[model samples]
Target: MTDALSQIRRIVSARTPEAVWHELAAALKPFGFDRILYGATSNRREGSVGDIQDVVSFTTIARHPGRGREDMSFFIRTPMFRWVMNNSGASSWRWAEEQFAKGLLTPDEVAARDLARKSGLCAGYVISFEEPGSRRAAALSMIAAPDQTQDSIDAMWAEKGDEIIILAQTMHLKIQSMPLKVHRRALSPRQREALEWVAEGKTSQDIAIIMGISPGMVEKHLRLARECLDVDTTAQAVAKAAMFNHLYANPTGEPKR
Candidate 1:
């Protein structure tokens, strides 16, 4: 626990999320995992499942040379991602193979597996972090080094799976604490107030009357909030703002909810 905490502190001490990701990847390398892909979304819902573009937030840290290109395609095609979508907890590449052998792999899933194999990513573990009663969830993949065989990777996991899970969990929580670019944009006071009221089920007219502002003014502020959040509707803006902790921000600028 002491060593794990120390590693987590080092990773979190990084000045930026990108730096934190790099530190985390380095920490996992000694465990035979040389590549990593970590992504999270606070907007998970029935409509958003299996749609990469609907992820409200995402981040990836990988040592693979083709990581940038791969990231773009993997989410839509990966069997591991499909598994994470339906289940919560840790799983390994062997689990994916079992699914494949069961004839559960779709065409895209087959393509994703072939791509990973071609890239020398033959063994890895995937961990899903899902908070109770929250739409937010995250997934982490720790891929074995190219030179490592499946047997060696499996042996390592059998020996240190608990430690690896702890490390990945620590990294996930630390990443959540760090500010993401999408979350850094602060809403104007009025914009936040409007969204907060909306969260309480207040309509624009209701909010305007409560705030002693004209209905037109309330609508204008809501529109600006939507634009700022890069969403098309008030509901989406409210959801997006909530993801950034803007709707119920405390005096210390942290989300109360």
Candidate 2:
């Protein structure tokens, strides 16, 4: 109990995703999970968690070239992703086996399952974080050591499931509050400033006045910002930048200078 609280403190104090991930990995290591994958996205819709490119994810597993770790699209094709999208809480990997036995798995899911087994990832646990707004989905997959069986993991869960869930939830909330980095090109300070002013309901000319720049330059900044965020309009730029936490904070989770 004391150790859990201390680990949560370390996780909360972490300023960067790498720092937090290290803290989380260390905290879960003793529980038999040797590797972990954590992913969250705010761009999801019904029955889908959106694209992996837009998700803010961190993994402890070594990402080898051409493996599923490098190509996260592999995860999206798995039945576990479907389960996390539809449910909450922890689930034993055997649930997928049962579904497969009942012929409930899709072809892609079957392929992913078979691939996982070949890769020595047949036993593990997954936790689906609850979505309060329904516009987002987050989950963590913890892969137990190869020597650990599903029955052993289940027994461990029976005793420490709540503790694991609490740790994962704490880490999730911390990660959410931290600055997010998406696959899009980062907006420049000028671009971020322009969008921030626009979010404050300022026009291009107004932003130019506040930023001490010409209106045409302001328009140029806004245009570049839109392009960087891959949005069609300045309004969409603001929303997308804000959605990824790029408008208010930097990668270090500190105020933009």
Candidate 3:
């Protein structure tokens, strides 16, 4: 078991979110499930209030018929998940709730019940992380069901909960380092300069002048940022970087740095 865990850690270190998602599904072979979805909560600002929503989900299946990634966005918002989040009966869930309730559940626990119901699931497990050093909390939800008895699968999940927790933490670290890896690869000195400014919410033209480059150059850096982060747009890249502390302009801006 220890050897398997070490191997899993190594795989996680070497992969993207997509790869990690599939690897996680494979690692969970002990539990007989037709589908697996790992959904992480969106990172929101402190004292900046709104719905505490989750975004950026990954999914895999085990010999089953269902919707693909596009279909996932709809199911993650179900009432069943909200009910479970509100009352999971798991010790970890209760602890997470207590922590978030006191100033927990960032953005104040988004009403995602509708999303959860759409997925057609019977059981769910949720876990939260502290984003390394910040008080900010991030949550992940995993839901499942299959021909195997619920009692049996629940037992497996309980026994393997610690392993899953370790996986989550390691996965979190990888995400937080993704941008730095990109920063080292293709970003030029001026491009990097523009990127840092961009990370701080500066416009392309603002970044261009700061880096003594053209707005076009700023646009180029934005494109690189998106490619490196494996996201679609500059805004997503920026949000991902800021939330994960993958890359930062001010050393003091991120809690761990």
Best by TM-score: 2
Across residues 67-167, which tens digit of lDDT does each residue of candidate 2 receive? Answer: 32353566777888889989988899889999999999999999999998898888899999998887888889999998899999999999999999999
lDDT of each: 0.73, 0.84, 0.51
* Ten contiguous residues minimizing lDDT sum, candidate 1: 47-56
Against the true structure, candidate 1 reaches a TM-score of 0.72
List where candidate 1 sits over 4 angstroms from the true fold: 46-73, 182-222, 232-236, 246-257
CA lDDT, candidate 3, residue 83: 40
Q: Which of candidates 1 and 3 is the stronger one according to TM-score?
A: 1
Instruction: Output the lDDT of residue 81, model 2.
Output: 87
lDDT for 156 (candidate 2): 96
lDDT by residue (tens digit), candidate 1, 1-257: 68777878887676555667777777788988877777777766762432344342333434444353347346546888877878788888888898889998988789889888887778888888777645766788778888887778888888888887877777777666654434334578898899899999998889999999999999999998887777899999887776654566553433346
Give the TM-scores of the predictions, in the order they appear. Answer: 0.72, 0.92, 0.52
TM-score: model 3 vs. ground truth: 0.52
C-alpha RMSD in Å of predicted model 1 compared with the true structure: 5.1
Off by over 4 Å in 3: 45-54, 61-72, 83-120, 130-137, 179-193, 197-241, 244-257
Worst window of 10 by summed lDDT in candidate 2: 63-72
lDDT of 3 by residue, 66-166 (tens): 33334344433433234433432233323333444575343324344323335454454655455443333334555555455446655777787777667
Q: Report the candidate with higher lDDT, 2 versus 3.
A: 2
Measured with C-alpha atoms, the lDDT of residue 53 in candidate 2 is: 60
Ranking by TM-score: 2, 1, 3
